[model samples]
Target chain A: MTGVRLYFRYLGVSFRSQLQYPASFIMMTVGHLVVTAIEFFGLWALFDRFGSLGDWALAEVALFYGMVHVAFAIAEAAARGFDVLHRHVRTGDFDRILLRPRSTVLQVMGLEFQLMRIGRFTQGFVVLIWGISKVGIVWTLPKYLLMALSILGGCFLFVGLFVLQAVLSFWSVDSLEVVNLTTYGGVETAKVPIAIYKGWFRRFFTWIIPLATINYFPLMAVLDHQDPLNTPLWLSWLSPFFGIAFFTMSLQVWKMGLKYYHSTGS
Target chain B: MAQIVVRDLTKVFKVAHRKAGVWQAIKGLVKREYNPVRALDGVSFEVGRGELVGYLGPNGAGKSTTVKILSGILVPDSGLCKIINRIPWQERAAHVQDIGVVFGQRSQLWWDLPVMDSFELLRDIYRLGPVDFNDTLEELVETLNLSAFLGVPVRQLSLGQRMRCELTASLLHRPKLLFLDEPTIGLDAVSKLVVRDFIKRLNKEHGTTILLTTHDMDDVEALCHRVMIIGRGQILMEGKLKDIRQRFARERRFIVELGNRYVEEEVKGRISKAELIYLEGNQAHFNFDPTIVTPAELLHELSAEFEVRDVLIENPPIDEVIARLYEELAI
Candidate 1:
């Protein structure tokens, strides 16, 4: 079988094992939906009190929030194995992956598929539809395609960050709070317009990490808005490609990490 | 031809050193101290194809390190290792495709999935064709008797049952080489016998070259004709099992149960070239050099002296031989 087909087979087994505890799965899913709903409500209350922040209206901020949360949810569901890779390394389970005749990345990618994240994904989708309706922008075919591309790009970016986190386990099997600063903290910062941040902060996400390429620039292109930072309009249209590049780079780093892997003692 | 050749392989580990107090832990964060320990020091050995070689060593003797390097999970610091003419760590994927490893302390099967589910996943991972997979699975199932619990989840199975399934899982690809690290470490006598029998048969029938690291002497004695003893990261002895025993088999133990209590002096005067090591109410133990006095001569003298109700003769245990070897070699 091909790697892709084997990946799906691993995912199928993971889903079945998780569903064996139906009650716990349902409870966790409901809990995820409720917590994200309250978080969005808190954002709505702030907007209700202040109408606009830094010249961006509530609907524009909601579009950013919805896009970031939706992409994050998808990445969290698919890349959970990387998110908790320290446990596998510490417990010596990573040795079993080495014994198999497949790429370690493919095996780790298929290690987990968290279906409960669908609850958070649904909430984000609902908020996105509500924001689009309230914004009153004429929706063209290109605009719709751009929006889909932005979500895909954002998912790829977050998954890349998670893969990088797992790669760090080769050197140290600690909790890796530093990588989380980029992943979880990046989600909160990307929910707002990158133009509002200071120059270096915005540049860190734009040039160094390219997180803004997935959401901020693509959103501007789709919303037909001008860059307050004076970036060329053509640059904004090419932002989505950053996700693919980042993902490819992370896979290379993962391969290097495998070479340096010091498997736990038996 | 030799299926595996390891020449002067060595590995050193830099372990962090920290004191117990919280103040020391705080100091460690600034500039940590590291102590270098040699886990494997110029170890070398060879195993021919279809040879079931027993790898023996006490704890902290680098047995597991050798297995990890041979199985391609670790890169040695120096020296050459070639399994089937391929460098293991350099071409890991291709090398591991023909090798199977099982660590008794760890389970390769999925914790929450059924035994057969893990097998099917391995089938996909190894890319075994349907027909080949089925034939191998059927043969292993028959040999290992895994049909009863194939549908049961791994979490609910006992250790023995889980180990049986693990053995079957590793063999599904029909790997030419097998590395078993303490394969029968904590099994009951019956389970150990079953596993040992299966391994012996597998080696004979399929010509699978197996290198087993085990602490169980029975496992070593039952399945291995050739044994390699390693200590302190070096091969101390490697030869046929009987040859090592004969080399160290100098003393014999004799236990005699008397019909009535006897004085120590009375027994001591009757025996020659034999020392009475221990004496209880009606039982006595003797350690005698077989070269000095034959067993028939000693037994005849003992029978003439005491009312010997029972007598048992035994060679010194293998554990004693190994412990003495370790001490004598200072490993």
Candidate 2:
């Protein structure tokens, strides 16, 4: 409990520091907002010309895109510490974390806050609301709970990927592009339904990274949307948990990698 | 009883190496090579309770490797390291609770936060109590003279002020053992003295065992009771500072000024065992082997030849002494 409380305090401290220069903070947040808005608008234009993607309208596809991006933004904010692990390892900043009495995971999590990700959050949230109005899903207590869980579970899945990338920093500081593929690729794949992709691509994401379990399956239950996969409603409700499980397992790998932590740079 | 003990510590690092040039870079892209560096080889040492020892070495002589192993930050390939009855690497979180560390090259403080804010964060990090933490902070701040810039961000503080803050940060928990890696590097003369005095006091008062690693021989001369000189992954010398100086540096410096002014040629012939190093304007400098000619004999020979106004004999500076020692060790 104390560790968690201290982690929150560290988060607050990081946020305040990033806000020290108001002009810079506002510029960065606006920059993030504009870049993501333009990217999403490009997708919107593509759907505008085609009218519908295999009977799935832009609004229907927006549900997946917005939810996946929303979860990613939250994970990026929470795992900002892991995002800079490469520099930390190369520069020997990781030694400071080891010297502390707290858990290494908590210490690294407290390293940064990345408050500018709020721009991405805001854009995704607005799109989610827009998608909700167009789709007109029947409101229920369970559906409301599933919506919250699906987003949070998706956040954990991305957090797991971030942790995995950070673990690779221990062995080699230069080769990180491959892990970036999984995280960004996971977001891109989970945004739309899996029907568009076939064969190995679908299996690679659904079984290997397991992003679809937390995002696509849980989201389908919330939308009452049918798919070719024919995943049971009860299974979809339980699939969000697999994301949390993946996060737990990734932390274990992080522990194993720490033993190989050959500290560098004096 | 010894508070820290290590036996046969060894570590080898596989460093990927490539020659310079675009062709080499392209070759490295295809096929890479690694050079294994033996950072530590069968090293062994011990520090008893409250002993402030200096771990001396040239660059890349495994000084930091030993410190890292002792502090539980790095795992050795094969070794037995027990600190306060616990293996550091096996019980890192617990072992670190009783130890403090300061890396002069790195800043543990947040760049944007005030000095006090970082201290408060450390308080919660070590789970220090409100009353105990305040008392320690008050005493450290007052002694280190940090009150003037306590509220300023760390980036704004001078290097001297930053070092003081780093010392305070490491000691907030009152750790039993402290590892300071070049703590006084790049500080002004006055700051150096202040830090040296504080370290001496911290050891004497708190009974803290300290392992100091530094390039500044003045720091070692001022603080360390015992010194260990490491070279090429091995200890070349270890003993009391006085004994090491006496054993390695047996040459004495002699200077004489003649009573008759502007008699540069007053002493033409050299003394039996003394070699004149510099002679100009009625003053002469000679370096004599102490075992062959005593200071009194050299002075007697000087007065017999020229009308000596005064005579002075002294030992060489510690920096020169250690430089010669390093040359002899061929590190």
Candidate 3:
């Protein structure tokens, strides 16, 4: 309970510290807003010209895009510390985390909750509301529950991905950039419908990284149709749970990394 | 039964090999080589309750490795270690709750936050009660004289002010044991004295057992009850500063200042026991063993022959004692 409370306190402190430089904070927030706006426009233009990707409409694609960015922005703010672990390990600042009496997971999570990432979040939120309004689907308690669960599951998945990326810093700091394929690459793939991709790509997202479980499976359950791969409704509904399972597994790897770090004493 | 105990604590590190030049770097990438360096070799020691022990060693001499292990940050390859009756590495969070650590080379406070914010964060990290937290903070802040910069961000403060804040950061939880690794390194004279004074009072008043590792001999002299001199991954010697000095360097010095009427000629000859090490103008330096002949007899004999204006006696400086000890051990 204290860890959760402390995590929020760290967020509060981090927000105030970033406010110390108002100009930089304002500029970066605007940059994030502008950069994400451009990305949305690019996605919007493609749907405007082609009408849709395969059978999926712009409203549905907008839902996919919005859900991905919203969860990503939250994860970006929450996982800023893990995202910058390479620099921390290189500078020997990671030792500071170990010295603290709290769990390393909580310390790293609380390192930063960036306010600028809210710009990206705002854009995603607007698109999401617009997509939901246009979808014309009947509202149900389970559907509402599914939407919230899917977004939260996405957050957990992204946090896990961030932790996985950071785990490599324990052994070697070289070529850690390659792990971006799963983290940043996960974001790119999840923004589009899974059915649009080939069979192997879909399976890779579903099995290897579990990106499909959080975005595609839940979205299909919402649309009331079997995706191109014919995923069952029950499977789609349970897919968000798989994302949570993946989160716990990622933490297991984190444990191994910490043990290796202790033994190395570097 | 001691507050801190260790037996055969050892740690080894593997350093990867990378030679100069771009060609070698690329070739080395394909076939990397590693060299095993033993950082700690069969190092052992114990610190009783409320005992202030100083661990002294040169760079790469395992001073930090030992501190790291004891502070619950690093695990040794093989060792039986316990702090406050708990194995630090096995029960890290709980064990660290009873200890505080500060590394002089690094700042534990948040760079952008004010000093107080960092302290509050630490309070939450340790889950300290508000009353106990504030009590320790009040005492540390007042004693360390950190109220002036308490509101200022850490990066904006001077090194001295920041160091004072760092001390408060570690002690806010009132840990029974404190590990200070070079807590006074690179400070000016006044800051050094303030820090030394604070350390002295903390041990005296709180009975907090402190393990200090520093290059400054003055810190050891002013604070430590006992000292351990480590070199090349092992403890060369450990004892009181005076005892170590007597063992390593028994030869004491005597000085005689001749009156204005006398010249350097009167003080050039050897005395009965002391050796005339140097004769410059009217003052003379004589090296003698205190056991063989006392400074009083040397002064008396010099006064009988020469018109001695003034005389004084002194032991070797602490710096010389450590240097001689290091030399004798060939570390």
Among all candidates shown, the one with the greatest TM-score? 1
Estimate every model's Cα lDDT from 0 to 1: 0.87, 0.87, 0.86
lDDT tens readout by residue for model 1, B127-186: 999999999999999988889999999999988888889899899899999999998988
**Cα misplacement distance, residue A243 of candidate 3 (Å):** 1.3
Residue-by-residue lDDT tens digits, candidate 3, B229-280: 8888888899997788789879887777877544445555535678887777
Query: Candidate 1, residue B56: CA error in Å?
Result: 0.7
Docking class of 1: medium
Off by over 4 Å in 3: A136-141, B26-31, B255-288, B291-311
TM-scores of the models, in the given order? 0.96, 0.96, 0.92
> What TM-score does chain B alone reach in each candidate, compared with the true chain B?
0.95, 0.95, 0.92
iRMS for all predictions?
A: 2.1, 2.3, 1.4
Residue A66, candidate 3: Cα error in Å is: 0.9
lDDT of each residue in A84-156, candidate 3, tens digit only: 8878777777877887788899888887788999999999899888888898887688987887788888888
Worst 10 residues of 3 chain B by lDDT: B261-270
Q: What share of the true interface contacts does each candidate keep?
A: 0.62, 0.60, 0.68
Clashes of each: 0, 0, 0
RMSD of each: 1.8, 2.1, 2.9
In candidate 2, residue A26 scores what lDDT? 96
